[model samples]
Target: MASRWIRPEVYPLFAAMGVAMGICGFQLIRNITTNPEVSVNKARRASGVVENFEEGVKYADHRLRKYVRNRSPEIMPSINSFFSNPERSN
Candidate 1:
């Protein structure tokens, strides 16, 4: 069994490679988690994006309501036609 195994002269090379890989992984995780400006900016940007999206939804809802009100006379016919029209079966 010993004769078929790797040579003893190269054992340290594998250990050094493992240690280097571990250090690189730890440093990458630390850089993402520990930077104060990056963390704060990320939170701020996420909240700003959420707020903007909420405002856009509200604005769209308001516009849709206004459109419905302005076209009240045609809304029922359009809805009825939408449900009963044979063309929709396709």
Candidate 2:
């Protein structure tokens, strides 16, 4: 439904912002629930279940970033190499 006060062009912007906020909120809640350091329960905080809290956090929320940590970051290797070559600058 279109409202007289809001412009139709602004709807997509609102939807994009809503989605971004939702993802951020989901991550925040996930960290609070799974990470012992941030968990609400005292028992889980002191259970010694995760010897290395950092590793545990990574494992609990493993994503594309973790899996590709070792790979080259260039999205277009050929393009990057072309621009970086000193001879090309001349």
Scored by TM-score, the top model is 2
> What are the per-model numbers of colliding residue pairs?
0, 0
| lDDT by residue (tens digit), candidate 2, 38-89 | 6577776677555676767675656876778888988997788788996875
7-86, model 1: which lDDT tens digit per residue?
88878998999999999998677555553333446566576434355645554566457767756466468668777886
Distance from true location, Cα of 87 in model 2, Å: 7.3
After TM-score superposition, the amount by which residue 27's alpha carbon in candidate 1 deviates from its true location, in angstroms, is: 0.3
List the candidate 2 regions with Cα displacement exceeding 4 Å.
Answer: 42-61, 86-90
Q: What is the alpha-carbon RMSD of candidate 2 to the true structure? A: 4.3
| Clashing pairs in model 1, backbone N/Cα/C closer than 3 A | none
How does model 2 fare in lDDT?
0.77
Residue 46 of candidate 2: its Cα lDDT? Answer: 72
lDDT of 1: 0.64
